[model samples]
Target chain A: MKIIACYSNKGGVGKTASSANLAHLMAQSGHKVLLCDLDPQGASSFYFRLKPAKKLSEDSFFTDQDKLLKAIKGSDYENLDVLPANMDFRDFDIFLSRLAKGHSALKKALKGVKKDYDIVLLDCPPTISMLSESVFSCANWVLVPVIPSTLSERTLEQLLDFFTQHKLEKSKILAFFSMVQVSKKLHLDTMQRLGEQHADLLLNTYIPFSSHIERMGVNRAPATDFAKATPAAQHYLDLWRELATRI
Target chain B: MPRLWHSQGEGDFTPLLSWLENKAVQRGLVLSQTEFLSGPLALIDNGDCQIAEQGKSLLRLSHKLLSISQRDIYPLHRKDQPPFDFPLPPRELCERIEQPPAWLLGLAPLRNLQILARGKGRYQQWRLTNRLHKTCGIIYLLDIELNGISAQHFCFCQTYRGFTKSEKLLTSWQRYIKDVFPGQTAGVSEIVALYRRHPLVVHHANTSMQKGRPDIASQTKRWLKPLLLAAFSNEQGIILDIDTEYLHQYRVNMRKARSLLSLCKGAFEENQQQHCANQLANWMQNTNVLRDLDVHLQDQVTYQQILPPHLHCQADKLRHNLQKERQIAQQRLSDQLQSTAYQTNKQILMQSIAQLNDGDKGQKPATQYGRKRLIRQLNKIFVLTGQLHDQSPDDELHRLRIALKKARYLAEFFQRPKTTKRLSVLASSLKQLTQDFGLFNDACVQQQALHGWLDSARAIKRPPSENIEALTLLLRYYQEQKRQTKYKISQHLRLLNDPNHQSALLAATQNLI
Candidate 1:
């Protein structure tokens, strides 16, 4: 099984939405996918209309296989399931510090579902902590959804510097422009500058800013399902196809 | 799991939809409907209903074959036409069928399926979704219209996996459906049963004679009519040359009919009875070469296994030649069966059977006649067994084998409800003896055929050394097989020679009669 982490240090970068949409598209392509809501906020779980998993303590999350499996809930679509997040996940970093193998704890926990799923998508929190470090260590690909802006560009550079300092494989990082507005000159300029600077890192497909994506909150479904004919959904499908070839 | 309900009412599904809508409203859920598959559904099975007997149904929807049970529906094959022979059905379908290779060799489509209707609006699916728009459960409604009869509908409800909240909703719906529809809680197997009830479907009828002093003539008719009809019914399958089993069963039924006629000596006029027996014998003789070729082709895998890898090519050549011969023989038999002369003969035989009456011994009670025949045949077998020796001729063994079969057939004809156990024991012993003889006979015949082929091949042209070697090895194998079977038959006869065992056999035969 391959693990893809939709991680970003900066919030409001459409990480959770991208993760939910990508997982849905992957499943629609006949892959058994599990969208793991590693965020304490449970935004991805909410988008699937699943309630937060109850009684899933941080300690049991990494050690107990049955408890982790029992916490997974089936989504409304076929071949897609969600491991809904619990409030206890806010202390995942704290709990991992107490473990003997803190760096590999998350990978070990994900091993339980190796045979059950073809793709385990981690909807990770926007933080650079011990838990994020474990995710970076174990994930096959770290998909960073970046808004086409100067601040997002600076954050991407910071993430790359951190990967360089920690000796992590920089090739594992794949960045894509999200919520891009073609009418804005600044967005276009920022994307052009970043695209040339990180020619090998940034994917070709981009998620355009659309009101249809915003309506996902009201529909409680992925954009691909509710707005299938829209360009935003098509872009997400194209993005998934590109990422699929890489992974 | 899906719950099914069958309704014999009109095809209107409005009542079900209304009830579902009300239930959805009460539970604060929305009910939605969509068009599912819509086409004529055809059910297919062989004469024996083997597929349905396994609690499954093979249904054709458009171009796909679906093997459906109570819990799951599997799409087995996708083709424009239904497959009716072995190896034509894909692996998915073959795996689902029991004893696929052997059983499927006899598979044929049932005739007179006019009960099936080609009606529109066949299937619809309804779903009940919660406030968050997640489907908790679904209901599939299938509409079946019988030709010249009222239309019926089957409703199946299935809950989504991992949706615990739908359990109570499913229960309430089940209860409501049962109360409203009243006696409609049947499953998918019922559909197969419905088709099997058609009168034109060929089935085996019990041929046991009547109880308590029945007249011999009526009892003979009762046993003889089904065998003749069943044999005649296989004519189409043989003419189509679909599989070897049709001819096999045809030969079997004719043999049984001949055996019964010979056993019941006085049921008809002497001349008429001899004519009927001769006709049956003639029909069997016409198919003898064809049946032998079919058997050899069926044993191709066994022949390959018996030879080494280097000889497989020679075996392949032999198989190809056998197949060519089989095609010719099958074509000949098919042409003959479809000929006017064959039909005229069949009509004459039927007329003779219809003219049968209570001739001299036919006025006797069937039980008495049956008992007398069984005891006489048993005594004849005993005498034959007594005359046997280590150096007995093949003709003597052949006579013994025929005598044993007649006795067994007589035993079956006279078997009473109360004497089942005793009859089974007698039948098993007879069966084992006949089976040993049958193997020995097959070996001898195969060896002769091989020798003839070898001589003909050498006379026609020079054959390869490998081909000659393979034929020699096969001949030797059958020779060894014949020897082994001879030894087994002798051992069985020696057991019969024990004085105590001989008296016990006589006693058992007497008691059974």
Candidate 2:
């Protein structure tokens, strides 16, 4: 299973949109995928058309990986699966802390579940709390959709540096541009500069600004599905293509 | 010191001890001896055998020859259960694991009616039993059913077909007694045998013990319906998992007293294992040894490939290229050289390399197992698409994780060669791959949860979004977990691409067929 986390320290960078589209693209490619909406804001769940779970339900047993994996649920797409955020997930840290190996709560939960999916996407809240830390520890890659602004860049750097300075594993972090307004010279230059400076780190595809993307909320459809034929669709298609192959 | 005290006198002493006990009990005499176990049965001490306060009804003596108990054994202390738990029939009942024509000394007619009720209550279950077959003492099943209120007296015969209220039952029951024990004829003519040996054990059911509580009548009719239905099914009692015999008990046990469970580990198919050996498949996936194939897979479908497959999709191209590369590899190694000089000089090196590769000389490239067969087998055990499959990705991710586990187990079993010092380095790469796979597995689980939530909405009969907003907060939380997993899987996979990690990975994952 490949994990891609759409995370940003600051909200409103289209984190949910990016995650939702990537999930769609991954699933479109015949890969069994799971889109986990872990943001308390639940925007990703909304994008996926899932009613946020009121509670964790019985699958909370999944958090304890040492025991047998309790089966779970999925989405409308054939292979796309998701773990919708729940109110109980808010208190997850407490439950996780009570475990024998707290650091591996998510890791343990992930155990014995890979046979069902080819890729898993995580849409994280814009926070640097323990949940984010836990997410970082559990994910295969952290995909930050920077809006190509100096502020977004700073946050991205912090997220990257947090893992790097700790001497944490470096290979799982994949950063790319999201909501890029190419008409803006700054957006164009930043995209170019990011490619030049960290060509290896930046994803070749950048999510471009699309008015239709904002209206995806009104339509209650994922941007990838809503803009299937648009340039924005290509962005997700490219991201999934890149990620599906990499994983 | 002797775990088995009755291993004496060359011949089995079980029958002899049974004979002696029956002789003493016929006249209601208590036999008392203590010198030795079963040599000559020397009389070491004699008494009228007053029952100890603990076990008030039976004799209070110890002998190595017999599996006897102290008189202090309270009637209540002995659990009254379906007799199979005992592993042997009552000495007074005269049944055993090695006897023939056995009978389950039945409950009194009224209790018999309670335990076995309705329709086919006396079907195949009443068949005569050989002494060797297992049967609990003084126990019988009843079939019956009821509605409106929970019936006080329930019968189990509803689920069993082999039960019958036939005369053959009595004859078979008698033959069982006469077979294991020939000295005494179990006094015939009784419709249902009382547990004649024990002194009518009555335990305090909080006060005055409720002995012989089972009443055949005044029971629900529900038991009868199910019992009658089950009796016709013919599979009422035999364990359905016949593969239990082939399964070996692992020294390392988990879960419960029974090491094997129909869930988790047992495969649904008994005949398919040899056809496709995957007992160790999960172990192998955990190890992620096939990571080498990923690069090869990537290269074939790569945009740079000179010859693209007929399909225009990148995925198709990748698949085709991967196949082509494998074919090329096979061809390159297929040609045999004729030179004796080259043969002798390069044979050892080639042989060692071939052994390391387990390379098909020229036949075919080994296929990469893409987590499918394992999933297929598991699905057979429990449908991957059941309501249990969920409306989301949580279960799918979980299934993936299971495969990863099998991979890990496989890798551990086939560790890099210890003889070579590079083995340590190889182990390190294998560890890195493990982390990568672990991250991937997490991502799979996170996604499943989302998909499942949507399904949950339908299951609960609620329209989408009516409760959706309320559920969002929770779903987001799960998504965050998945997002994090993506990072880890990517990071770990990249780590494997590192040149430094490659040699080690190959070393540990070297095919050794």
Candidate 3:
């Protein structure tokens, strides 16, 4: 089983949208996916129309395997399930900091479901905390969705630098441009600059900005399912296919 | 959870659709429908309904084999249309069939049911979705037909996972269906029952006789009629040259009929019995060469294995020659079957059997006659057993084998529900003894046939030396095989000579009497 953490230290970079769409696309391609809504906001869970699993708290999430598994709710789509997050998940960083070897706690919790799923997608909250450290330590790939702008580019560089400083595997970082506005010259220039600077880390495919993606909030379903013919959904499919080969 | 129900009458989907629509409205769900039609499918099975007996319907659509049960349909990937006598099912399908390999080897399509039109089936899917268009529940309405006969419509409903609202709808729908279309859970067995009742599917003629106090002549007629019909049923398959099993079974039925006449000698008039025996023997003789060539062609791979690698080309040539001979023999037999004289003879034989009168012994109870015949056959076999030796000639072994076969057949003919246990054991022993002897005889016959073919080929045209060498090697292999079989038979005879086994056999037969 593979673990892909859709994380961005910087907020509002299409992280949740990319995670939800990619998870749906992966399930559509015959992979059993478990999308973990690690964010306290539970945007991914809300998009799947699943309420928060109140039985699962931050303390039981890493230590109790049965509670963790029982909290997984099947989504409306086949082969896709959701582990919804409640408000208690906001304390995950504080709970992890008190535990010994907390960097491996998330990996140990995910060990129980190795046979149940082909991929475990973590829809991580936008933060640089102890929980993020554990994700970086455990995930096979840390997928960073960067909006094509100066701020997003600077945050991606900061993430790369943090990986290098921590002696983490920088090769595990797969940054892709999300919510791309091709009409803006600044967005195009930033993408070109980053594409040349991080040739090996950046993916060739980009998720274009579209109103269909925004409607995922209204449909409470994956964008790829309801707006399958739109460019946004098609780009997600292409991105999934490209990532599928690399993984 | 999924539920399946079958309608009791000519199934109409209108009521169920309306009920579902009303339920959808009450639940504030959107209802949608999709219709599907299948291509023409053929249902294939042997005479015994072996596939269906395991609660599976094996259908052929194009080149694929679909195994449908009560729950699901599994399409097996098969490239070619299997012959009437399939050697072995594909690997994926073998586990699905519960019968032994030998039983599967004898499988042949039911007569007159090679291609049945059972493809006019249509099904409609009704889906109930929420505002988000997520399918919460689905109901499938299927109308399947066999030939032109309409079968009951089957309705299957399943609630989507994690959708509890649909579960409530399903429970209410199940209750509604139960109240309306009560007492039917449509399964594969029902479909098989439909197939069995089809007019075009030839069924096995009822040959079972009354258990107690049957008259000799009437019982013999009951037995012989089905055998004759079974034998005649294969004539078309043989004429079409569909597969070798048709000819093989044709000869077997004829032999069984002939053996019955001779074994139950006193049940019919002397002249009638002799005339029927002569007719059967003539029919057997007509297909004798064709059956032999068929066996040879079937054993072509074994023959190739006997020779060295360099002789494979020669073996192919030999196979080619055998194929040519088999073709000519098949053509001759086909012509004979289609001939006016053959039909006239068959009709006369049928009429004679129907018109046969009870002889002096025919008035006796069938059990009395059967017991007397069984004792006499057992006595004859025991006497033959006493004369058996390691140096017994092939002719003597052949005689002994025939005696055993006749005894086995008489046991089968006289078997009753009350006396089945002892009679079946005796029959099984007899079969095993005969099979051992048969193996020896077959090897000997194959060796002689190969030798004769080699000589004839040399006379017609001086064949290649490699071909002669290959034939010689095959002849040697058969000779060795015959020797080994003879050894095995000798050991088996030694076991039979045991006092305990002999008395057990006698006790089993005596109890039947």
Candidate of highest DockQ:
1
Which candidate has the top score in TM-score?
3
By descending lDDT, how would the candidates be arranged? 1, 3, 2
- Over the stretch B1-513, how does candidate 1's per-residue lDDT look in tens digits? 122333333435547578768867887878888546667666656545666666766665554444555554444533324443322333434555433433334444322112221333366667777787776677767665545345666666666444656656766766776677776544455566676654323456477768768888778888888898888877876776645666877887889899988888987778888888999999999999998887678668978988999999988999999999998999999899999999999998888887876668888888878887888888888899999988888889999999998988888778887775877788888889898998888887888888987777676666767877888888888889888999999998887777788778777777776
lDDT tens string, model 3, B171-271? 68778777776666564566688666533333354555577678989889888888988788777668776556667667777888899888888788989
In Å, what is the interface RMSD of model 1?
A: 4.0
User: DockQ values for all predictions?
Assistant: 0.12, 0.01, 0.12
Identify the superior model by DockQ, candidate 1 or candidate 2.
1
* DockQ of candidate 1, scored on C-alphas against the true complex (2 decimals): 0.12
lDDT for position A9 in model 3: 91
CAPRI grade of model 2:
incorrect
True contacts kept of 2: 0.00
> Considering DockQ, where higher is better, how would the candidates rank from best to worst?
1, 3, 2
Off by over 4 Å in 3: A1-247, B1-9, B12-35, B60-114, B123-138, B145-147, B159-163, B174-209
Query: Chain B TM-score of model 1, please?
Result: 0.83
